[model samples]
Target: MKRFQKAAGQWLPKMAKLRGVTAAVVASVALSGCGVVNHMVYKTTGDVLQGFSRNHTVPYLLNTDDLAMGCAMSEATTPLLMSFGRVTNEPDQIAVMLYLSAAGCADEQAREHELTGLAALGDMDGDAAEDAMIRQKRAHALAAKRYFRSWQHHNAYYGEPGTGECPDFDDDLDEFIYMAGLLSGLQALNAEIQSTSAIGVPKNVGSMVGRATSCLDNEKWWGAPMALRATIWAMIPGAMPEGENAFERLEMSDRQGEQAGVRLSHVFHAISAMNKGDNERLRDVIRRHAESIEETPSNEDWAFVDAMSTQLIVAISDRMWVENNGHRTPLGQLGTFWDDEQEDVETMDLDDLL
Candidate 1:
């Protein structure tokens, strides 16, 4: 039987591609006939996926090939990207385990354990449905917000006037900034969702879906940051004068792009379903997002971003699959990332770069 585990945190470009050979091998195994021979292949796939987290605590060294792949745009920007890689990689690995199980590649026992983990985390005293959804969203939001802060530092080129030397500033940093904006918007929405009195299930889920889908249909990528904000406000229910004019500001930004919008739309759809108590919809969103992830032939950088995003989605939504199939676990219900910062006291200095 094949074993599975969950991927935790965000995924960066460096860890996005598992070598073309590795990806090809996984795809081959997945497509092969299911029997004793294929079983062996499945087992190997599980092992390779799980191995990603064996040494998560160490700093990842960028290889010569990685540099050749355009990872080093600037010194300040490079380290931040590396940090993002580590932060995102943790949760991403945990997500991978769930995805494998949901795909029917994991053993029955493992599936059961995965469900138990998700339930434990979100059930809040073994309730029928998850009660900790809001709390869980907050934590995810915080991590994303922190990452966004770092990304902004790196994107100093885009910073407002009078802003001092951005230690991590560079031209290519816009991509990172755009990505961070999506994550931050999600975090804010999560915060708003948690503040609702609607218990485990909420009516605003549908509204959120509508808003997110509206953005997608309109092909408004940059507007997503505000869409999420609007959704969060709507979720608050009858809170007169929705604060922070997210919609107007998001509409004003002229940095729309296909990749960012696609990613945001897919994620919003998944979350909307989960909040609506429609696990089936969530499942479909997951599958659709997974399929839409394409490796572009012209731009290798965009391909890396898409691949990494797909990997993260697979890992994060894998647990939802288990829950829909009657498997409930703490791990399955809440996507979690372990933060080493809480345990360490070392402060990083940025004065030298300035």
Candidate 2:
């Protein structure tokens, strides 16, 4: 009986160890299964978000004419949308638009601050002007950073600009995104210059984007590609091609844009004119934009793009008005200047009627 008891005790301890080993294996599998389930859930969710954003949200935003609403959406949702990058491939195309729109908001704020500084200087309030200038710089710096972020995403998706062959775009939307990316790079450089401090925007971005515009068909894109290249040529010393006149090309591009009802090329023309201190040319460009939008109506498929052009043109007009008149362009007077000649109107003769 003692021998039997000894054998039974040894068997019982072995069984206990065996049970513990089985329990550990089961627990490990359960934990591993949870991890697999989590990865699948996250990946699925990311895919859905990415698909919806690219297919639906982007198209809806592009169709609308409300820049303020678009800007708000960009600012509010960028973080949430971008966070999905942790679980899946980053939605670099959407990132380009989000950052670009957000940058526009910053750029607008910077322009307002610049006007405020100008007004303060006009008042001879040196301290106030300096303060406004500081604020302007900060806003410009923010704009530069956001624009650079967009450029980075652009590079990720389309390959580095000025590098090897252009991307094989899947559709018109892909091509449009490429153009926006180019614009983002150029804007980043401009905003960095305006900030007056090195905001890490590469100086070579101008020349790079200038070359990158060649990848796009200028006519298919409503002349915007050439306008962008021409603007860079005008802005950057020696960037223009041999025998090419930047302003002339800009004028040609302007015609194409006006006819297409996109009118984005006018923004580049105005930028070039403003940069060169050619107020006459700037005014002409703005006036043309005003008349074109009034007569042509924005392209139905790209109304948002047309509206953006108008917004930037009006901002430029406001800057000019504020500089001279200490106020923004008056309502319904975007194309008219304070000093412009008033048109003669036929008046009824009261004495003759009497």
Candidate 3:
């Protein structure tokens, strides 16, 4: 609690200076409004404040691909940012939800960097390898932390199944932000669990995530909501209900995202395939991504997000190449296999290594 207070104190000054307002002042305003009206206002304000966090924080952090920046941005924005949710009077629930969702998204990149770094450390010195391992463990740990935190908040806003404390969004932005949080959080949680050293993945996580964000309309969220649902379906055994088609839903999301011009749903499918250890499916998705890039060269909105997603896919390709042949993916390997037409490059394999 003391630590929380101290950290909150530091940001309070900046919050006042930049926004010319303080959460304490907002907290004092509860005396003047009806309970319901005040609750909506608080949640709406918190929802708006998170945009500033996403805008001012995410681009710079993604460009440099820095882990510290991801954590720093989380700390820097969350305190004063939570105040918006606080003022809204939803038991500080929305504030908690906003903070975790944004932080979890930021941490997703951190986890990916660690995964790639582990692969990149191949053939390094003992000391350097140990250091890389240390960093990777910590990175996964942070990723797990943010994801679980988001999970807790999701439960808070909407209680466990059959016990209804449902979330009602204020607008499109509100719903999008909420679902984005769930998407990132669930993905992060999966990565953390795979790391086997991640802290705090829920034991009942499968059930928790299976039914999460059920309120999201597919077309409304540009297929992201379904993409997330498909991910949980594909990754968790028996999680998909009888007669439900996970792949079809994933493909549906892919089409919707492509039509929406966001294309993030593909990333979800690719990541899911990777998790399931279906190399053929992974390759298929990667090929599709490359072909898509070939067809539509530029992504005007979410350029960096889409680029980073591709980078991770490339990192996966790099892993395959490293394990198969002694290097990262060949420069021309994506969308096309290296062994197909590139005669100069030997079609190396296990036989060559053995």
Candidate 4:
């Protein structure tokens, strides 16, 4: 009995150590299994969100004519949608649109502040004008940042611009996204210039975007590619091809945009005109845009794009009106100006009716 008891004591510590090691192994495996399950869940959820956003949400948004709503949606949902990149591949394609829309919101705000600054200058309120200018700069900086983000995502999706070859687009949507990216790059540069600060926008973006436009077919895209190239030519000194006329090309592109019911080229035309300080040409572009929208129904599949063009045109008109009249364009009166002559009307005297 004494020998048996002594042997049990000797073996007891080993048994306890064995049990402890076994428990650790089981716990380790269980923790690993939980980790695996968690990863799978996250990956699946990310995939679903990415797919649904690209397949349904994007298409629906593109069809809607509500620019304000779209801007709000982009502002509200960009973070949530972008977070899925942690678990899945980044939705760079959708990111381009979201950032572009968000940038537009900022750009619009900047324009408003600019108008306020102009009004203050007119009132001779130096302090107020200075404050408005500061605010406008801040908004323009924000716009530049957002537009640069869009350009980055476009690079991620399309393997960078000015690569001397176009990406093999899967569909028209892919091509559109590519174009949006090009627009974003150009906008980033423009916004940075407006902010009068180095917002890390590539200085070469103007030339790069100009070269990239060659990838797209000029006629099929409603002359937007050429319009973009021509705008770059007009903005950047010595960028135009020898013997080519940027303004002439812009006029031709404008006609194509008007006929195609897209009218994007008008925005470029107005920008170029405004850059050159040609108010008459700018006003004519705005008037033509107002008339074109009324005359041509927006292409059904691309109504949202057409509406966006109109939104930009309206913004330009508001700036012009505010500068001249201290107010925005009147509702349903976008084409008319304060300086426009009153049309003659046949007036019947009330006494004659009586």
Best by TM-score: 4
lDDT at 195, model 1: 37
Please give the RMSD of candidate 4 to the true structure.
1.8
Q: Show pairs that collide, candidate 2.
A: none
The models' CA-based lDDT, in order, is 0.38, 0.93, 0.63, 0.91
**Can you list the residue pairs that collide in candidate 4?**
none
Model 1 accuracy (lDDT, Cα):
0.38
> What's model 1's lDDT at 249?
35
Candidate 1 lDDT over 247-276, as tens digits, reads 343233212323442344445445545555
Query: For each candidate, how many residue pairs have backbone atoms clashing (under 3 Å)?
Result: 34, 0, 1, 0
lDDT of 3 by residue, 110-189 (tens): 54554455555665555665665566666566657666666566556545432354477776545654565565456556
Worst window of 10 by summed lDDT in candidate 3: 89-98
Residues 287-312 of candidate 4: C-alpha lDDT, one tens digit per residue? 99999998998877777888999988
Pairwise TM-score winner, candidates 1 and 3 = 3
Q: Rank the candidates by lDDT, best first.
A: 2, 4, 3, 1
The candidate 1 region of ten consecutive residues with least summed lDDT is: 56-65
Indicate which candidate wins on lDDT.
2
TM-scores for every predicted model: 0.35, 0.93, 0.64, 0.94
Q: For candidate 4, which ten residues in a row score worst on lDDT?
A: 297-306
lDDT of 1 at 297: 24
